[model samples]
Target: MPGRSHSGGVIRRLAPLALMPAGAFAVHQLRYWLAFAGRTGLLLQQQGHAYLHSVVPWIVLLAAIAVGVFLQALGRAFGGQCSLPRQTVSFGALWLICAASLVAIYIAQEFLEGLFVTGHPAGLAGIFGYGGWWSIPAAAAVGLVLAVSFHGAHRVLHAVADRRARPAVRVRGPARARAPRHVPAPALAPLADGWSGRGPPR
Candidate 1:
């Protein structure tokens, strides 16, 4: 299992897909908890509305999942040559990518909302000018957390797969063929010539 430690079947590869959304949801909850520590009821209620009211969070989740799947596909095509430095760089790039994508999507959503309310949509700078820049750092922070979660989950899954793939140890020794249970005594032979049943020759 030298080279195959990181490699696995379909299930092992696809298992991490669920972690992407779970990480996103966990971060959202943490944000809610921090923002509304006193109002437990409102905080609990917001969880449902979070996804129902807006498409932004769902879109971000989908985008993250898509990126994860793409990376897994790439890992499969090439081998799982994920060294420590390589994974760090990869996830770091992922953090930047997710942050950029999330910010862009949020801006687009804001633009659409503005266009719906007012006839004209706000210009790009106007969108960023009016307190919209905050989204950048927030998204980047969330993206960083998600990237770390993904990396950790991947390592755990591969470790489990490697353990399961190992060959079982043998306990009993090799079997040997059985010897005959009983042996017959040699038959009595006749005496020298001219001797019958008597002890000595006639």
Candidate 2:
């Protein structure tokens, strides 16, 4: 055991990957709560909040990861690194997609709330429209943050994968050539005198 150590524990190493998304989700929800506490308090208190909470946020996270991968792909397309213009374009595309998706999801949720639940989030109706200028921008902001988060997650996952694939022992120097073994010469019976093939013994 002298020259040996191992990253034997599987779950321990992967703890970061599992924890990162949870942490990001917590921060995302907390940020929203803090920002909208004054106005959207009643909407947040509604029973249908469960339906909204369970589904939409996860969709946002999926979008973020997809956007991040797209951005990374753009980066690779340009000189194996992300150019500033390409990054800007990717972020812009992400923002558009994110903002539109949020508004659309909110509208659909509101429609469903109207149908099933009692009073709907009438306030959220103006989200990204007239009174709620902050709606799209806010969603885009979250998208950006989550994009960066998932990008980091992507990197961490890849690094873990690489680490797993790599050989445990790293040899620094060239492998030593095996020395030839000193095997003894094979024994043989003694030859009789004049034992030639062409002539018999005199």
Candidate 3:
């Protein structure tokens, strides 16, 4: 149906935009899972258990992924029309923006964790204390990965678009074999000697 085909086309166009975000989310979840399984010190504690039991971590994670999707969509909007050097610069800027955004999100997550899990608001001084500087480099690294992911996704989308835009080739079936024409063999050269039925002139 027309509607189905149209929807499929739309999905095809939009799917690549989410690739980077989806990958980011997967990596984030994997890290969390591994940390949880290995009894790592990464998971923070609130009362007597890990703060992950609260809903805030999941909410923050989803929010981060949403931010990622928005960034990827933004890249999709401008990255394709520009030249390679321009794209490189723009994506580099995007990386810096993502790093800054991550830092902000980290601060917010810390604040929210305190408010909901510890029942007190976290002071900015405490949030940006000595160990906080680690966030900057971590976020920068994450952003760089995301920037590369967005570029890869763009390439995939371009390839798909090119493939879809190409004209279709028609393939024909093989030709049928024809029968040979009959020529009657020139009546066998009149029997070579005109042999009569009267016993060959006895």
Scanning candidate 1 in windows of ten residues, the lowest lDDT window is 77-86
Which candidate's TM-score is highest? 3
What overall lDDT, based on C-alpha atoms, would model 2 receive against the true structure?
0.47
Per-residue alpha-carbon lDDT of candidate 3 for residues 42-125, written as tens digits (9 for 90 to 100): 443322226444644665665565556545544544444311122344777877776676667666765665566553336664
Count of clashing pairs, candidate 3: 0
RMSD of each: 9.9, 15.5, 9.7
Q: lDDT of each structure?
A: 0.54, 0.47, 0.52
lDDT of 2 at 41: 47
- Give the top-scoring candidate (lDDT): 1
Arrange candidates by lDDT, descending: 1, 3, 2
Which RMSD does model 1 reach against the true structure? Answer: 9.9
Estimate the TM-score of every prediction.
0.44, 0.38, 0.46
Global lDDT of model 3? 0.52
Model 2: runs farther than 4 Å from truth? Answer: 1-39, 42-99, 121-130, 168-202
Model 3 weakest lDDT span, ten residues long: 79-88
Q: What is the lDDT of residue 172 in candidate 3?
A: 86
Candidate 1 C-alpha lDDT tens digits along 1-202: 7547555444345544544544444444444445455673473443233332465567577666656664664454344333322244577787787666656656665566445544323566434543446556666777787677667656654554455556669898889989978888776565544456866558
Clashes of each: 0, 0, 0
